[model samples]
Target chain A: MDLLTNILGAIATIILAFVVGMSYGGIVRKITARVHNRLGPPWYQNFIDAYKLFGKTTAIHHGWMQIMGPAFLMVSSVVTLMFVPVLNNGGWFTNLNFKGDLIFLLYLMVFGPLGMALGAGQTGNPNSAIGVTRGLSQMVGFEIPWVMALVALMIQFNTTTITGLMDVQQMSGTWLMFSSPFAFIAAVLAMLGMFRYSPFDIVGAPTELASGPVSENGGKFLFTMMSSGSIFSFVKLTLYVDLFMGGADNLIILLIKTFSIYMIPVLYGIVSPRYRTEQAIRFFWGWPLFFGILAILYAAIF
Target chain B: MINDKNSQKIVDIIQNWARKHSIWVLAYGTGCGAIEIPPTMTSRYDAERLGVRGAATPRQADVLLVTGYLTTKTLKRVIRVYEQMQDPKFVIGFGSCTINGGMYYDSYNTIKLLDKYLPVDVYINGCMPRPEAVLAGFGKLQEIIAEGRANGAQKYKDNLEWYKANQKKIIPSLLTTDYNW
Candidate 1:
């Protein structure tokens, strides 16, 4: 009975994440269209697109690895979702918030991209190869400040698990956003790259790279990637909410918090232009790196 | 129930509905008519509102928008691109150039009839169709899709030899590697 309930809880969490994430993606598209002064598709457009792609008949693939690419991405996304806590103190929503889960999460997040890189390489498309390199290089660029920020939080709170950090925020009655402003700033800056919005979006560079890594993917392969992408985005946002904004107690607060957090990258991406790989690395290492160090200093001193 | 004709019809209806609402056009600008595409995609026109957006590659695209006059030289590449696209795909012959060849009707290199080489699902008739015309053409395609009438890909499959002969007449050195799939 316990095992069945756990399985059901996991399924519920996956469904919730997929729905919220897909809606957020649609909202971003609408927001982007509105910014450009055009009427956009309805907020459920992503769902329609995903369904269409799912129903599409895949005719060709380079090899087995090409077929496995989306599967790897889906695995990464679902696993990451399983690890994230959706709501604070909510039974069943906390799927696997074990000790030292944050460190495990940092590694798990990159696993999908690397697996995708291998699959893309098998397709033998030059653009996919270039995209994979740029993506990994950009990953290296951003992970530094992101790691520093997390380390600062860990040192200050003296806890390795997300739930422990949440407990600290709850007991203190103040979110970490206020208590550790520099870490938040550094992390948010790293997130701009993590989300791979404009400036940092050189990995895909759709106009130039033929959509980068997924250039050869279509039909069911594309559908899996698309849905996994939505789920992954939700996982990232919920992790942020848990880490910095104080995890929400209910679904409404969770939505509001995650949406507000999502707007940071989406709005920034709209106005900014693309950055070359080196320039993006430089940008992250510059101000965000300095802020990360300051966050460590603040944590150590106080 | 899964194998029943009625159930299959219901599935087709739902699939058509979803397909009609999401059309990813290939961003291959084959000719001068490409200029109008920017405005159509941008704020003033915004084809995205109707679920029409540019896809970056042949693999990802549903609709191949042949923008303008295709010389014998370019037709080879266009045929290759169209073939690379997956099943249930479409082709839109844009501008007067792709139809009767417009001013290029007398030109030795330009192919007059596009449907001779690939099945064109819709044609936007103009020297250069404005953004409004482009959107109208898309609406027509969407209507055809919703009605289960857009079967250009299937038509191409059924009459491959005829289309290949037409293509080979223009580009005698056309490679057959694209047809193997």
Candidate 2:
């Protein structure tokens, strides 16, 4: 019975986490549209996308490379999942709570998208190459802030376990999002951008470049990449919530806080148009960097 | 959960208006309908506020706007992209190229009716529909959405054969019941 509960918990948590990430994204997109004075999709829109992708026939370039594309994405996302303490919040398989673990894991998150981009580039198509390059450039732009924000958290908290950070928050009764308000603000903004939504989403903008690098990836590679992305996103979001909001035995609390952050990108997307590559990098380098550095200073002083 | 970023009164009003306004279009310009998209997006027919910019990629696009006639060569790419786009994604066949294959009616390359393959939401009429005709089609699309004409899964199940037929026509070698790749 205990084993069954554990297994069920893992499964439910994984499913719920993925759904929340997806649904959270959908909600955010909807809210952004509403913010822009337009009615957008219902909350379930993300799931509809997942289902639709499954329905479409998968394609492969070279049978070997195409097979590896989605495989790498899913594997990378799963690796991303391992580092995140989703249900229990302490740590689990491949948890990176050891010295430099948090930093190591954070860097690891970049691989999934990077691998997907490589897979797309190798398809030997110019259009896909353009898309991947754009994606890589966009990822490069946000990489700095993403690291700085975490460094700020690590500096203030003095520990790197995503779980340890959450433990501190629970014990101190103050979330890091609150610990360094500027860091929280900046990281929230950058992390909101981690998935690379609009203004930053220029990397994979389809109409502009035909789904970017991912345009070339198909068949199981596309499937695994997308499938893992969904679940991996859930784990990532759950980790964020657990770190910032504290974990719960019940799922409702999980829903509220995670959904709140998940909506950040969606809301930003609705009101603004996508930026040019130059503009996107400029915003990341200028505004986010200032805030990220300030966050570090604030962490030091406190 | 405890914090409310915007006041309730304002949020409600804005949310209401947003539901009726901005509509993002993917604008998959393959054949000729693609040609008309530029004029509509330019200053004269500016669709910026309505969120009608052409998304170059399928993932972030809200609607897939078929701009012209799809050839056997281009049709495969179109279908693949059409499938890639996220859900709540609408498909608009913007030219006679898509609606009935226009001048290429008897040509082997053209798919007689695009809807036979994908679930088309709005069908604009014209050998090559003008930008004006495109907008009119969009207005109708918004109306259909408002009236709840988008039935996702049902539309897919009903049009499975159509999509399959298209797959065979475009990527014949790839049109297998099982994808080994």
Candidate 3:
């Protein structure tokens, strides 16, 4: 009975994450359109797009790896979601959060892109290979500060679990965003690269690289990758909320918190031009890296 | 009774509705009509609100918009792109040139009729159709999709030999691989 209940809870959490993530994507599109002084498609446009892609008649694959690329992405996103604590108090919303899951998550978060790179390498498209290289390079660039910020937080709270961090925030009546301001700043800056919005979106550079790694993918393959992207974005936002803000107790609060966090990247993307690959790497390693070092010093001293 | 046929029909309707609302157009700018596309996509016209958006590549595209005249050289590339696209795809012939070669009617190399080489589902007519006409063409396409009448890809498949014969008459050295799908 317990096993069945746990399985059911995991399924429920996946569904919730998918729905929230997809809706947030649609809202971001609407906001982007509004910024451009144009009326956008309805907020449910992404649902239509995903469904249409799902319903497409033909899906072409270059090889076994091409087929597995999207599968790898789906696994990574869903697995990442499993480790994130969706609600503050333990309930059906919480999946597999455990001690030291933060460090595990740091590795798991990057596993998808690496797996995708291997798959894309098999496609034989020069653009795909180029995209994979840029993507992995940018990953190296962002991971440093992201890790440093997390390390600072872990040291300050003296716990390596997300749930423990949330507990500390609750007990002290202060969010980590206020307590470790430098770490929060560094993490938020790292997130801009993680989200791959404007100024950091050269990896996919649609106009230049033909949409980068997934240039050859279409139909069901594209559908799978698109949903995985949506779910992964939700996982990242929820993780930030859990770490920096107090974890939410219910669905509404969760939405409010996640949406607020999401607007940072979305609004920034709207007004900015894209950075080249090296420029993006340089941008992350500059001020964000400095903030990460400052965060570590602050945590150690205080 | 929700028998197999009825259930299949129900699924078809839902799928068609979803497909109608999301049109990813791959614009093949073969001639001067390509200039009009910018205004159509940007804030002035905003075709995105109508569910007509640009796709970066042929694989991800639902509709192939052939903007303006297609010379024999460009037609070869167009055929290759169209073939690269997945099934249930569409070809839209944009501008008067595509309808009957417009001013290129007297040109030796320009293909006079588009449907002879590839099945065209919709054609927006003008010297260069304005963005409003382009949106109207998309609206017409949406209607056709909703009615289950847009089957250009199927048509091309059924009469592949005839289309190939017409194509070979213009370009003797057509080098695309066989139609796998």
Alpha carbon lDDT of each predicted model: 0.92, 0.67, 0.91
Every model's DockQ, to 2 decimals?
A: 0.90, 0.10, 0.84
Lowest lDDT sum, 10 consecutive residues, model 1 chain A, at: A89-98
Q: What is the C-alpha RMSD of each candidate to the true structure, in Å?
A: 1.2, 10.5, 1.2
> Regarding DockQ, does 1 or 3 come out ahead?
1
Give the residue spans of candidate 2 off by over 4 A. A1-10, A32-39, A87-100, A218-221, A247-249, B1-181
* Ranked candidates, highest lDDT first: 1, 3, 2
lDDT of each residue in A1-302, candidate 2, tens digit only: 87776666556555655666677656665666466555555766555545434534443445466556677777777666656665444433223346666887877888777767666767776777886777677677777877777888898888977777867877888666776777766666676557667767786675576666666554234445656867776776776777666665456766666667766775676557788888887887888888889988988888
Clashing pairs in 3: none
Per-prediction TM-score to the true structure, in the order listed = 0.98, 0.66, 0.98
Residues A110-182 of candidate 3 have per-residue lDDT tens digits of 9999888888888898999999999999999999999999999999989999999999998999999999999
Better of 1 and 2 by TM-score: 1
Q: Which CAPRI level is candidate 2?
A: incorrect
Task: Give stretches of model 1 more than 4 Å off.
Answer: B178-181
Per-residue C-alpha lDDT of model 3 across residues B89-142, encoded as one tens digit per residue: 988999998999899999998988899999999999999799999999999999
Q: Quote the TM-score that chain A achieves in each candidate.
A: 0.98, 0.85, 0.98
Candidates' interface RMSDs, in order?
A: 0.7, 8.9, 1.1
